[model samples]
Target: MKEYVLLLFLALCSAKPFSRPSYMTLKNMMLEDMEDSDDDDDDDDDDNTLFPTRTPANPFFPFDMLPTCPFGCQCYSRVVHCSDLGLTSVPSNIPLDTRMVDLQNNKIKEIKENDFKGLTSLYGLILNNNKLTKIHPKAFLTTKKLRRLYLSHNQLSEIPLNLPKSLAELRIHDNKVKKIHKNTFKGMDALHVLEMSANPLDNNGIETGAFEGMTVFHIRIAEAKLTSIPKELPSTLLELHLDYNKISNVEQEDFKRYKDLQRLGLGNNRITDIENGSLSSLPRIREIHLENNKLKKIPSGLQELKYLQIIFLHSNSITKVGVNDFCPAVPKMKKSLYSAISLFNNPVKYWEVQPATFRCILSRMSVQLGNFRK
Candidate 1:
């Protein structure tokens, strides 16, 4: 009699069956498609391979339960986010159409190729401040439509290059990057913003054509081990960072090709002089940083920068400022302060001494876009 009653209870409780296919099947399918793409392209010419690769192309975002981005902290019911409860890997329960995925504080160190197998609509993926060390090259290959990628505060040494051609923004601050590949940003025409702060650079590590073809707004490389700037920088670059480097000189040839550059930073380096004509090509540059260096004089060609605004030249070993580098611009009434002079942090020779000192540009709030230094 008890056995009969137990069977009835089991049937009643397990009656409602839903279809939740195991993720393994989808993982295998995606892998097989990847293998086929490789086999099809091994020797086949690009013209002969007319079939579109089987990778996820058009991602459809379904926000039913996958809308709220996940943090390493908690979980949220698609509508109300609570917290992530000890997730070791990317959450499997996330609806397929999740757009932005923030895995900031997770202990996830490894990302499998199929981790992002089917989700196509993903745009922003922030994995900052994680304990990750190794990441596969193709870890983001499937995310062709991705836009902004933030991987700061992790253990990434290798700069993520060969990114999808559609990338726009990349941030990777505070990492142990010894070298950077030349082909790192090759073919990234649409890229605009890049940050690479607090990296220990190597001389041979940055490939000659590393930033061959990218037009961007800012390229922050402060607190790096760079000895000199690459000569082939795109003229379209607006802002630059050369702080905390080993650079000793800035010759006229250094700025000969930078025509449209606006801002420049050369603080905390070994620079002693700014060669004349070095500022000739930099027409649009308004603000410049010459702080924390060994400079005793300023460049003369800087007069050509008619749009010069604020010039940082503090924290140097200079005893006296040069009498004749350039005259200051008339301070405009507008908030667009284009004044040229260093304030605080340097010993002025006489009472009338200008170009005397500079200050720090530790714009911490500015989004960093460089190596992910942990």
Candidate 2:
């Protein structure tokens, strides 16, 4: 019986070309390469745990009644791969013990309430590149353990309601989401990463208390229609990318609450000026990306950030590089030296800039200053 099961497992493995190796495949490969010795008993015990044996006392018991893989999908261990299958709806035959399901690149339109009825152990769901426009409020009620969800490149205009509170990452990029209600993320205390870029989100669309209950650390709202920074973001954010927007200026109070921010991206916008002390609010910022804007000079407060390493200021209208623009006059106060400072494509004359301007830079190559042709 053990040999029969081994043969069946190998046959299933070789039946398809998997895009990526599943956990079971890697484990089995490692087992095969290990030297056979006195540890064979331990290996056999592990194998039995993975593929259990039928009880000899009840020989007529239906041992093969376990839930099988969906018709056109591949199932191995606790993962189900149904991506790129042109599936119009969720498959009903998914095993009860499935931990992850890949249904990306499908034609599925909407998720019905019972689509994932009994999947209590489900941990992740990938539904990217689908035609999903609506999802039933209780569609994910059974998947309480779900942690990661990918709904990018869908037709949804708003976030799905009643999402599993256990979700840690939610990617809804390239959607039509315009408005965000206050209770959109109410019970999601475990959420940390949110990627909602490439949406048509309005500046006032994010209602107050939109992120009140969450402690999200990373948020990317790039390529949106925001005219000004939304003040409704959680203060626990570490990385905030707002590139490719219509924002015109960075007010002093724009980031007053984000004191723990480490990286801020404002590239490819219409920003013409940054208030004198605006960037100083984020005392712990390590990187700032403000390239491809209409700024005429370096944004102030760069000299106050001791941990700042990279500053992308290229493709701007800056006309000069002051000696104290990036580095503080006192070297002992800087906790980290500048690694990369880009100022290319700006109107600043590189020859007129003194060599002492970049004295605190790690290397000469770290400062990019040429290519200012009009």
Local distance difference test scores for all models: 0.66, 0.89
Off by over 4 Å in 2: 1-63
In order, how many clashes per candidate? 25, 0
Q: Once model 2 is optimally superposed onto the true structure by TM-score, how far is the C-alpha of residue 177 displaced, in angstroms?
A: 0.8
lDDT, candidate 1, equals 0.66
Give the per-residue lDDT of model 2 (tens digit) for 100-128. Answer: 99999999999999999999999999999
Which has the greatest TM-score?
A: 2
Summarize candidate 1's per-residue lDDT along 133-178 as a digit string, tens digits.
7777777777888788888877877886557777789888887777
Give the distance in Å from residue 283's predicted Cα in candidate 2 to where it truly belongs.
0.9
